[model samples]
Target: MSFFYSSIVKFEIEFFGHENIRSNHQKTIEITKESHLTPQGDCIVGVNATSSCADLPLELKNKLKNSNSKIKFTISVGDDEFILEGRGHPELILAHTKDIVIRKSDFICPRTLAIKCDKASDLLPRTMVSLLQNPKTKGTFTIDID
Candidate 1:
């Protein structure tokens, strides 16, 4: 028997908000299927969540660490609001490059915004959390990646 080797690629997204309270919300993360494809394959969408202060819940974090397929997650924070981001693998990358629409809305109360790659697949939730938790992170914040 012969097996093919596939490279695992991960794409990361960053969410920027005016304040900490404007970063946490479910409507902020959105996913839509692409229109066309060249080679054609199953697209996997993974949503990762991290907080500026602490790691996501052990259960959720463990789930992401153990998954070999597409998955999404909803994370909580100690603060009022936070930013959410997502990343995926090759399948998702193909879909994204094809001009697929992955709309991520923002929180309504404080009003927040999320940005995603139009031609890339996967999102690095861990890195995003670290970035937001930098010493420069002066305000409270949270993150969700589902």
Candidate 2:
């Protein structure tokens, strides 16, 4: 007998919000079938609560060459947390500022998320937690692979 498992699979997720808030738990996202088929390509990912440039702290905001631009996050995937900056949008996290987190289902905006790592097959178009750094933090984004 033989068994096989494919990396591509549908996903359902639960996003845990701030510790004080429990009603915001169990959030979900819907994706199209097409977004799941692309293994080594880019797909649209809806990001919530992405701090605007104006929202950024004065110190972090001042370092940017363009104050008008939005701040980009260091999109890291998997346990190793490899960075996906090259494929990311023009906005950046910059050298300073490490305080960032995603939580709940705000559906801030759908941004493009590229899958171009050696472990691409292992993760793509699936449901997973992006940033739940600690017990106090419920995480920032809930990703769903179609």
Candidate 3:
């Protein structure tokens, strides 16, 4: 028998934090294309994002839609860095234009970048979250799938 495997796929996005970033939501972590944020958006850690789900490369999106794919989400801000592990699902559409979300649940949605994530907004380090409350904070989000 013969088998085939796909090569690793990578995508990166840049965004800035907002003054309203709370990062308190228990189930999700999110980055949005919108420049402004309200306190109610507790899952949001970054705003004025350079890329949304709709902007992800098609190759990376394809990998993210595969049920067998493993995903690594790397977040870097100044000197601090965080790594999140997650899995892809066949249900992922990766089509939302305004937001990119990572969820700890298995729920699938247009904005969801990865489901069954190992961490959520509330699980992030408090020090990192504090830095994210400043609009001057710059962040890089890198996604790798295989």
My TM-score estimates for the predictions, one after another, are 0.21, 0.25, 0.93
Overall lDDT per candidate, in order of appearance = 0.27, 0.26, 0.90
Question: Deviation in angstroms for 130 in model 1?
Answer: 14
Which one wins by lDDT: 1 or 2? 1
Tens-digit lDDT track of model 2 for 26-121: 222211222122222222222223432234454433333232322223333334232221122224442222112221222222321221112221
RMSD of 3: 3.2
RMSD to the hidden true structure, all candidates: 15.8, 16.7, 3.2
Predicted structure 1: lDDT: 0.27
Name the runs in model 2 displaced over 4 angstroms.
1-46, 66-73, 76-80, 85-146
**2, model 2: CA deviation in Å?**
64
Backbone clashes under 3 angstroms, per model: 10, 6, 0
lDDT of 1 by residue, 1-146 (tens): 99976433223332221112211222233222222222222121212212211223443333333324333322222243323333332222121221222224211211111223222222324333344333233322222333
